[model samples]
Target: MTAETLSIPGLAKPASRIALGTWAIGGAMWGGADDANAARTIDKALDLGINVIDTAPVYGFGHSEEVVGRAVEGKRDKVILATKVGLNWQGGKIFRDSRPARIEQEIEDSLRRLRTEYIDLYQVHWPDVETPLEETARALENLVKAGKVRALGVSNFSPAQMDEFSKFAPLATIQPPYNLFEREIEQDVLPAAVRNKLVVLAYGPLCRGLLSGRMTADRKFEGDDLRNHDPKFQQPRFDQYLKAVEDLKGIAEKHGKSMLALAVRWVLDRGPTIALWGARKPEQISGVEEAFGWTLDEADMKAIDTILTRDIQNPVGPEFMAPPARNRVQGQ
Candidate 1:
């Protein structure tokens, strides 16, 4: 295809309905992968009309960004590239660091590795209790002013946290984990994001691997991946998680889609947010494309919500939706 056809058709676009999640390109989510695979995965995503790619330096210990740099070479202008700061790479694992100095330094490093002059959407990967939210806010604003970044966002912010940061600058989006198993976001973050005109970039819309339907504990990742660490994998909850997935399997079969597609469609039907489809392999990546542009009907929506709410032990917690007191100021 010609460059124009591949390139994002518009400049200064608000955001697109489909975004390719590059966590798999980073290749460390489950560990034990290569740059070649990551590069090819990105190419496949672009060919499939996924013009938005989200990456983070912490992904693949900075190796993912380097791979992406190589993958998108000669076609940098074709896609909207979004990456995160506030994620630290150290001791062979990723951790959170939202300090203003760190954010600046990491973005510089990210630009160097990604071979980009500026990031399209630079986000605080997560909240840093150690630094004031305002400090992080100001740092992001400076990036925009200097033209080092196009927009700013935060991952995993509560309503109050988003509000506090907005006092300093407009937030383009908020990235949070939302999925069939994690529908609690609908109670507050979704509505609050809508009120503020912020995009709700929903990460983990597939619930790691459960909603994908290829999961089996027999498949294991080395080191402490979030799947192994997440509470749902533990005893009593594991059963609940399995039941929910199995229940959806029937619905997916009836709809003639994989559990993955059903899970993604559920998120897209929720509202304005974009769902990050994590594809570890080319075939998996291809499979997810079917989920695009499809909306879940009311029966499927109600069924999915019932499965999620009834399975979660604490639907009211921050893991689902933050408390109301913390959310009141988010739209202010």
Candidate 2:
């Protein structure tokens, strides 16, 4: 299987269009995870030609980075390490904090956890309304100047925020929640990235497993699984999404692919994007190769829209995943 590739301006090698996402490997919110399994999963991704590993400190409260560090040890040069700053957590509560001091501290911590001298793609995890964009951008700019980071990117940022962020730093990419179910970015965020010539790291390509073809009506989420809180998983909405997923099965079968492959293929065919595929176990990523080497034409695209419109009466975005701001936490 030939995976599509994208070239970032400063990176040494082209990155696979399908990036390995470590949010689930963190094992904090998505039920639980095992370190050994996480390591194996990372190794499997690398073996499959997936060089981009996207993780964050808040993921499993630093556990994810530690696992990634150990997994990529001695092979650091082969992987494109993409991690994030901003969003501080305390007592299981997370809030956005992108002050210069916070960013400065976060980079060192990230480097130590990732066990790397320099981060290939260092991104601000979210927009901090409390901190001025210039301050955060300049702080990231200094990292590039000091050789601690190679490129800068932002996640969950609006076009206006990117405009302000670019003034102080050369923005290379943007990470946003995007999938077949949630397409809020199509209105403005995607257009802005195109205008700015920024590569898009489209996360949640499977809609948090809803489109993966594994979910069933009787399946249950345990512990603090974030899916339990997702609106789409609730009644009525859940049934609507499931029906759409079932209807989408024919499209997948017509293309001789699994629903997971079809879902991710749809994302890549939408635009210039690197679809982030989240996994905690090696088997979960087994069919990743299927997502490549396929393109959905205009008719397929139109049929997908028709199925979604016919099955889903109400649609929801991934806004529920956003962490609260510092001010909101303080008020409580």
Candidate 3:
């Protein structure tokens, strides 16, 4: 791979520093998706040396995985395919369920949708407090031993949760929401991943497109766009973040990179094992090369810190988007 790669303890191969994220391609929360274009984007990403492809069943409710399956038909051996479990949906309402039976059934369903004999990495999409950590870990461990999954991972799990999970199974990776704006994980999850020797696959490196620098005060998010509910997209907060983006233009120009590249590069420089970039079109990845072959210097980091501290007076995390556990669900 042209992009730098990192070796995880139990993974079959090192993954590219940039992984093609498929949430947008799922054609759900982020709005419409063109399957043909998405398949082409996947091909383009592989040709560009991005070897890791991350998706989930909840993303478009298996539509993402199906599109991914079509894209990797002949090139499965050339990439590291990662998808997740635990989250389930019915009639467009999402809920968390990590019961052993659900995990078993979902693996087969995922395998069928992915059209793959075995998944390279199978992660728990989110923690299910109703399900015992041991139950989930044991189920994941069974899959590994049975050769259905090459590695086990968990997403959005805290250090304490991971500690309990480790008692029953080995955690190969930690997939969490991490970006310049969402620095909540840096203080704990990141350090825990390092200490536990789990690879950190940081999603939302572009902060759900806010860091793209193309977002303006008048930009509109329509349909079921998830950003519509994000606090960063709300009035005063949106204006403040946009101002930060405006200021970041100079920093990006100084480094001879676009805002998108600067955002991705910053995440890579900040120590994530891999930065997952979500894309639905080939051109969206045109600036990916800028994320490589350069490192953000101390001055650059300082400027970013200053801008964030001064601009975002009321910062927030991705906690608002978390799905409800089975026990906590009011209705069905």
Q: RMSD in angstroms, candidate 2? A: 1.0
lDDT per residue as tens, model 3, 50-148: 999999999898999999999999998998999999998767889999999999999999999999999999999999988899999999999999999
Model 3 global lDDT (CA atoms, 0 to 1)? 0.90
Model 1, which residues run further than 4 Å from truth? 1-11, 89-95, 308-332
lDDT of model 3 at residue 113? Answer: 96
What local distance difference test score does each model get? 0.74, 0.93, 0.90
Candidate 2 per-residue lDDT, tens place, 1-332, comes to 56789987568789999999999999999888798989999999999999999999999999999999999999998999999999898788899999999999999999999999999999999999999999999999999999999899999999999999999899999999999999999999999988888999999999989999999987799999999999999998999999999999999999999999999999999887999999999998989999888799999999999999999987989999999887887663
Question: What TM-score would you give candidate 1 relative to the actual structure?
Answer: 0.86
Point out the worst 10-residue segment of candidate 2 by lDDT.
323-332
Model 1 Cα shift for residue 167 (angstroms): 1.5
Best by TM-score: 2
Best model number under lDDT: 2
User: In lDDT terms, how accurate is model 1?
Assistant: 0.74
Candidate 2 TM-score versus the reference: 0.98
Q: Give per-residue CA lDDT, model 1, range 282-322, as digits (tens).
A: 77676656676456788877777777677656532225222
Candidate 1: residue pairs that collide = none
* Model 3 lDDT at residue 204: 94
